[model samples]
Each structure stands twice: as C-alpha cells, then as structure tokens.
Target: MCASACYEIGCALGDAPTRGTLALMLAGLLWYVGFIVVASILVSFGAVDSTRRPGYRRRDGKQEGTLMWPSLVMTAVVAASFAASHYSLT
Candidate 1:
C-alpha cells in the first residue's frame, strides 16, 4: 500500500518513480510472505516457540492465517487506477 501510494504521489508531484521502485516493492512483499510462511512452519513443528502478545482481534472468533491475498489485490487495484489516471491526464 505504501509503495503504490508513494508512486502515485510522486506522479502527482511530476517526479514519477522509475520501474526500479516497482521492482523493489515486489521483492519486499515477496520476502515478507516467504518469511511468514517459514516462521509459521517452524512454530508448528515445535522448532520455534510462538507467542501472541495482546492485540486487537476481530469480533468474530475466526482466526485468519494470512492477509496476503487481499493486500496484493488492493495494491494491484491502486496501481491500475494510478496508471489509468496517469494516461488519461496526458
């Protein structure tokens, strides 16, 4: 989200970011997801201890393992919207 927002803001300021920024953002997101999966697997197998600090929870009792899909979808939507707006402005 921050990545796309930064890109859009840079565009608005007439200092658009290069493709390198997009590549970096993609790499960062992938690294994050990979780390989460590895940590979860280790915790499950008792190789690593898991700790849940006090934090807000959803009203529903359902436990969600990951929000990666929703985040990626939103990022794509924002990027597409920015591209559309950028082209239309030209």
Candidate 2:
C-alpha cells in the first residue's frame, strides 16, 4: 500500500524520478521484507545469544541512509505535485 503511494506519486510527478530511484525503492522494500523474515527466524530460535548473533546494527546506518532519503524525496514529490496541480486549477 505504501509502495503504491510512492509509485502513484511518481506518476503524478510526471515520472520525474530516475529509473535508479525506482529500483532502489523496490530493492528497499524487498530488503525490508527480508529483514522481517530474519527477525522472525531469530525469535523462533531459542539457541541464539544476542551478543554472539549477527545483528542489524551493522547495517542500520546504511539501511537508514538508503531508506530515509528516498522516502523523504518521494513524499516531497507527491506534495509538490499536489501543490502544483492545485495552483494550476485556479
């Protein structure tokens, strides 16, 4: 649903985003789903120790870097599109 909103915003922006931005958004969504799976697997296992186990803390910085900018960019694109449209109608 959120992904759809991003794509719809892209459409309204006249597809101004580069193909790479779209691809990153798709990849981010996939990676987020994969992260959920990993977290579930860890919860299901009773043997893993927190300190000894692999942690997303290692990737947290990179993940945030990739995720935040695109979301902000997309939201801005949507809001700007709506603003432009509203102004054009008047």
Candidate 3:
C-alpha cells in the first residue's frame, strides 16, 4: 500500500516527468488498487470472521516515546521511498 501510494504521488511530482513514467506509475497504482479491492471482495464473501484469540490487553502496553507498528511501517516505507527517489539522482 505504501509502495502504491508512493508511486502514485512520486510520479506525479517527479522532475522531468515523461509519458512512460506516468503510465508506469498509473499502472502500479491500478495494480495495487486492484489487489486491495479483490482482497476486500474475497474477505467479504468467502472469508470467515475467525478470531483466533482475543487481543491480550496488557498494562504498559504503550509507551509515550514509542511509535505504533502501523506508524513505524508507514514511516519506514516513506523514508525508504524518499531515500530511493532522492538518491537515484535520475
């Protein structure tokens, strides 16, 4: 998903944009969107609500200075992508 978002946004805002890059970026965006929609449909129709185990709520589960998993993932994805884009020097 982050890759998808990165492609969709990066291509639009990149320097020396070309038709090929735009097309490729759009294609990547479409592919990711398709993946998500298909997964949603499959889950809604065929997947079961199988909760293996209830979440174990613990004391001190969160820390003030700690980032959540999703936040961490997003940050990593964006940082990696930004680095890749800027470092490419294309």
Candidate 4:
C-alpha cells in the first residue's frame, strides 16, 4: 500500500525533476524489498515470529528476543529512501 502510494505520488509530480521521480520510484521498490523480502527472510531465520501475542506471558516466563534490530533496519531503509528523495529534489 505505501509502496504503491509512493509510486503514485512520484507519477503525479509533474513539475518535479526526473531524478526526484526516479528516487521516489526507487524508494517504493526498496520499501517492498525491505518489508517483504527481508522481513520474510528474518522470519524464516527465527528473527521474528508473527504468531506471538503481545503482553502474553509464557508458562516458562522466559523473555523472548527483541525486535529492535529488525525494526532499526526497516527504519534505516525508510530514512535512506527519504534522504535519497531529498537529495534528488535538491
């Protein structure tokens, strides 16, 4: 959804330079790859588990792995995309 929105926004920017448009398109592609492909790989590697319920304490009371790294990577991707778009616009 967000990726498509980015692409649409890029397409709608008629006055923007070609580099800006291409940057947005590239950002959209990166969004898809980061969220879908990389996320899937992380899940397969046990880095993430979507089935776990929030605030649900396990019988063993063991703390589960944190999602900090995965989340940081996603955030970095978004930040990089934004930086690319900003630089292209300038």
Candidate 5:
C-alpha cells in the first residue's frame, strides 16, 4: 500500500503523467481507501474486539484484561501512514 502511494506520488511529480501512471495513482488511492474502509468495517464487525483482552478466567481465579494489542496495532498503523505521507528527501 505504501509502495503504491509512493510510486503514485513519484509519478505525479513527473513532467507529464501518463495514462499508466494515472491509473497507478488511481489504483493506489483506491487501495489505500479500501484498507481504511475495510479496517473500519472489521472494527465495527468485531475483528478488533476479538483481539481485545478476554474476560476473567475462572480456573486459577485471575482477572487480567488489557486492550494493549488493539491499541498498539492502531497506533502503529496511524504512525506509519502519517510518516509515509509526510516523508521526503528534500
């Protein structure tokens, strides 16, 4: 996904963007948007909820629940995307 966006941006900076490049850019944008939409759908459908800390177990009698993984994944995704969008070699 990142590669698609990067290539799209790089192509856009050229003198005259070709049809192929334009298609690539469109595809990249679609892929990026698709990911976000799918992710949101997954979250709403409880894909994220499954990763959330489970309820207390009644064997050794310990109540330990933490929503660390979901938080971390979300944070990392956002951070990586932000960095990619703002990245440059200027």
Candidate 6:
C-alpha cells in the first residue's frame, strides 16, 4: 500500500506543483519512518509481542488487537494524501 502510494506520488511529481509535491513526498517518507520507529519501540518494550508459545495453535483466536487502530489511521492518511494530490492537480 505504501509502495503504491509512493509510486503514484512519484508519478505525479512532474505534474503537481513543486512545493506541494515535495511536501507530500516528505510527509509520506516521514510517516513510514515514524511508523517503523514506533513499531520497533513497541516491540522492544514488549507491548506488542509476536512470539508463540508451546501448544499454541493457529486457530487459538488470540489476535493482536493493538494494530487495528494504527492500520486504519495509516490508511486514512494515505487516502487523504491521494485526495489532496488529486485536488492539487485540478
């Protein structure tokens, strides 16, 4: 998803205003980097453990509920960015 957004944004550079394009590019880059840093910190702190225990089955139904919100927020950001880019081109 991020890769696709990056590609679309990159493809628009030639058409969008230089300032807006640069800002969008920088914002997208920062968002991905920030997400990675935050996820690393969470994992390091054991707030988001991914290890499996003995006898744990794939259908145990224990899911990581912490990721949904962040994923939704990220999707919204990407969608908004695309919308902004689209409108800016008009």
Q: Which stretches of candidate 5 lie over 4 Å from their true place?
A: 1-16, 46-90
**Candidate models: Cα lDDT each:** 0.47, 0.45, 0.50, 0.58, 0.53, 0.59
lDDT, ranked from best to worst? 6, 4, 5, 3, 1, 2
Q: Count the backbone clashes (under 3 Å) in each candidate.
A: 0, 0, 0, 0, 0, 0
The reply for model 4, stretches above 4 Å from the true place, is: 1-12, 16-61
**Each prediction's TM-score against the native?**
0.34, 0.35, 0.39, 0.40, 0.40, 0.44
lDDT of 5 by residue, 12-81 (tens): 5453347765565555556556666755665664654444354544356553334545646765775576
By lDDT, who's the top model here? 6
Query: Candidate 1, overall lDDT?
Result: 0.47
Runs in model 1 lying further than 4 Å from the true structure: 1-16, 47-90
Give me candidate 1's TM-score against the actual structure.
0.34
lDDT of 3 by residue, 1-90 (tens): 545555645656465468776566555456545555654654553323232323432355532322244445645655665465444423
Identify the leading candidate in terms of TM-score.
6
How well does candidate 2 score on lDDT at residue 74? 49
For model 2, name the residue pairs that clash: none
**Candidate 2: regions farther than 4 A off:** 1-16, 47-90
- Please give the RMSD of candidate 4 to the true structure: 6.3
lDDT per residue (tens digit) for residues 1-90 in model 6: 445545665676566567866776667656655655665665564443455544433466675546557656766876786577455633
Worst 10 residues of 5 by lDDT: 81-90
Question: Where does candidate 4 have its weakest 10-residue lDDT segment?
Answer: 1-10
lDDT of 4 by residue, 36-74 (tens): 666566667553454566564456875465665776777
Candidate 3 lDDT (Cα, 0 to 1): 0.50
